[model samples]
Target chain A: MSNRYEARFSAVGGQGVLLAGDILGLAAQKFEGRYSLQSPTYTAQVRGGPTKIDVIIDDEPVMYPKTTAINFFLSLAQGSYDAFLYDLRDDAIVVIDPVLVTKWDEKYKTYQVPVIEITKTKVGKMIMSSVLSLGIMIELTQVVSKEAIEKALLQKAPKGTEELNLKALRTGYEEAQKLLAQET
Target chain B: MSSASSEKSDIVFWQGNEVVARAAIAAGCRFYGGYPITPSSEIAAVMAELLPEVGGTFIQMEDEIAAMGTVIGASLVGKKSLTATSGPGFSLKLEHLGYACIAEVPCVIVNVMRGGPSTGLPTAPAQADVMQAKWGTHGDHPTIALAPAFHREIYLDTIKAFNISEKYRVPVIILIDEVLGHMSEGMIIPDPSEYEIIDRVKPSVPPEEYNPYDTQYGDVPPMANYFEGYRFHVTGLNHGANGFPTTVPDICHNDEVRMIQKVMKDVDTLTEYDEYMLEDAEVAVFAFGSTARGAKMAVEKARQEGLKVGLFRAITLWPFPEKVIHELGQRVKAFVVPEMNLGQMILEVERSVHKEMPIVGVNKVGGVPVPPYEILEKIKEVLQHA
Candidate 1:
């Protein structure tokens, strides 16, 4: 695999998509000793508008921070999924919330993960869905190791929510592993 | 395990705006006065949180005008002061910026550019303010503006801005577009000894003998802080060596010329640029700020395609590196200027090269960045015509 990998996280403004990108970047740069960059689409509204963050993780220095092609794409909302689904590599791994995203291209490899449902039912917080999605993204891309993800996530987790966030991340990882086994 | 209290790591993923504030603190900037605006608010926010921790002060003033005024006021009283804003707020600060220019107060202003004629695109990135930065404050006053592309450069250049401002006793502006301001990246925090820190030269004479605008001490007179027992007049009008307003023809002429000459005479020392693979290249791409990041990639891609193209990325935007551009004009066959504006710095390039070679621009003002492929296509198109 090439040293450089670009991942995009998309959702509504209040959905914590940017925070997820930040955690992944922290994991790569601080824990994994890799270089990472993140650029987010800023919206005027505080909530309910489409927002996305393009993250690049590389073994070498990242010259151009903006992503031209995506290696891994995750979308938690239908509008963001539709708006940002264009520039994906041929073998790009696409992850989506099945309930939120109803449409997809059949030719592309797609994973339908119920991120919001999992966060609400298993992790006990709707906002934890972003962290949950980061787990799935890590399992698929391996951009940063699980240990690094835990260290970075716990560092960023809100007061008293470390165990809840870790539970959400571990649950997402296990679900993705089951999907990988089924694919084989 | 609470995020509210976490161990401090040596290196953290920081936004460009955040890094600017951290660097300002590291550079001994003790006062921040700013009116928060989109794409530049993070600088003010980070300063508000960190400045107090370091015994520095952060104040959110009533408006952009007051913000600039407070920064100038603070700087006059011996505090290394700073203020940040976007397009509209930058316009408001210009009047006071000129005041600081004439009064010879040392301060730093950061303009994190957003798309604008007036609040055109608050959250979108644009580089249209290139000319506005150089000529925004009115008159023919000298300007020193630094444009940094990445997070690390933002940190380094922000400190450099303070150094240049203190050393010259002139206001320095750091230009960052919305993309560079908001982008988050990894940057290693440098040790204090790794970079040179320059504070303004204090007046060596006694209080009675001190002159704020003394010309005998060469172009840059040793500055006296307001409360440092030296009382001197300060005004926006043309002033003499005593810092009082002057209407005398010779005194006015000499003072104005010196104000401009102090920076102009040192243009060679002030000019900082990146020349990538230009030694044997026939074409050069002139870019700055975030646009140069893509321009560098385009140069690499063109080199792989057997094209002789190089990138001249300007770190110092103002005092326009004319000498180097003139020298490069003699060697290169064509110039490709790509900017986020309709066309601003391209005019400077034309003036510097004196139209000696074919010059073209890949201009964009739609709040979208000019991608690498588009820049590469422009380079090829320019070469075909050349």
Candidate 2:
């Protein structure tokens, strides 16, 4: 693991992407015993506008809270992908939701997953898509442990839907592991 | 049981605004009066829910003026009061802020600044309020304002603001920008007993003998509560030692001079700053608020490139640290100031150094923070010119 890791989660408003970043930061700080900083940006509109959160995890203190260069970029929509494409480093990993993000560049290594479909089918809610994408990112990058993420999810997830969200997270993580194994 | 004692004492993650609300509670703040505004509404919301549970009072006033007025009233009755607002709301509270200064009420006013002249960007960051925090009240009264760069510093600074307000009988301003207000980071909420908490000094004389603005012992006069049988007047007028309105030339002149001397004379104890990599440095970046975070990173990167760069961050914004800047000016080659506003604080740096060294400003005003690379470029430019 590197000393510093920067990740950007981009999605439209009301997708719970900001909450996903909050939980990831909490997991890294509270459970993983690391330092994390999360800065979120969104428009004045409550929904249907582009939103993004920059999360920096490090062993040392995070001096600059904003992400300078992206190490991992997760795009849940084509608009967000296009808006944040210029922020990626030369060798950054890009993750896209296949249903929402249709266009991508061929030069960068990209991973496509049907995160929204999985959340809708397994968790019976569209808002859980961010939690599903969070699981996939954790499995692929291993930035934080699964146990830590699950602990934060239990603390932050909505009441009475803990079981369904847990199931969605497990399904997303298992599928990502299978994809990486096949690639290897 | 207090949350500090009941909850886990280890490190926890919290947003900057939430930390401010929690720190107020920890510092024995019993009354919160505020109006909702963008980028700062979370502080009011958290206080609304937390205050009642802790046996304190929370009020949402009709407007920002009334909000500040309510807190000032509560403070006169011997309660530690606080109010949080953003740019426009801060503007509306300036009238009452001047009242608090002249009446010698101890309270805390938090401004989580967004872009402004008038609501320029409700959700973006700007440090344009640097001048307003000092001169916004429209008077020659003393002001002590603090600016914190990160989440952990926000918690400690909030407590310090309350303490300074109580100790000196002045309204202290905690001026934070939108980026620090909305960001989340890991911070350790210390045990309640670990920090020093100061309360207002009460009157030692009898009710009939007590004078509210008496300055015989020192510049700061001991306070008396409203309903504590100490019948005294509180107003924005130029009053004498008896707390009533006065027009005598010597009485009014002395009153004004005492207010200024109370804060200006104790500049050494009132000012606080963070100095980074200043040992044998040639160039120093002077920044404050959220911009200081980027300045620290720029200094670190410059050090790696064999550049003698350091950072001078002003945690205490007002009663500007002139002595420190004057001493460093004789040693350092140049000063680079980066801020979210367009050269608001660089003016102070220039005034302090007396043009003895080259001072450069890298400013941004469109609601975005000045990035670290921009400051690095300015540092290189200043080095070449020097």
RMSD to true structure for each model, in Å? 3.5, 3.2
Model 1 chain B lDDT-worst window of ten:
B1-10
lDDT of 1 at B228: 76
The TM-scores, one per candidate, come to 0.96, 0.96
Off by over 4 Å in 1: B1-9
Task: Write model 1 residue lDDT over B1-386, tens digit each, in one string.
Answer: 11112223676788889999999999999999999799999999999999999999999999999999999999988899999999999999999999988888999999999998999999999998889989999897889999999888888899999999998889999999999888898778978887899998998999999999997888999998887799888999988899888899999888888888999999999989999999988899999999998898899889999999999999999989998998999999999999999989999999999965788899888887888899999999988988
TM-score of chain B of each: 0.97, 0.97
**What count of clashes does model 2 give?**
0
TM-score of chain B of 2: 0.97
Q: What DockQ does each listed candidate score?
A: 0.45, 0.47
TM-score of 1: 0.96
Error of 2 at B339 (Å): 0.4
Residue-level lDDT tens digits of model 2 in A41-139: 847777888888889988767787787888899999998888877657888888998889998987778999888887777778787888888888989
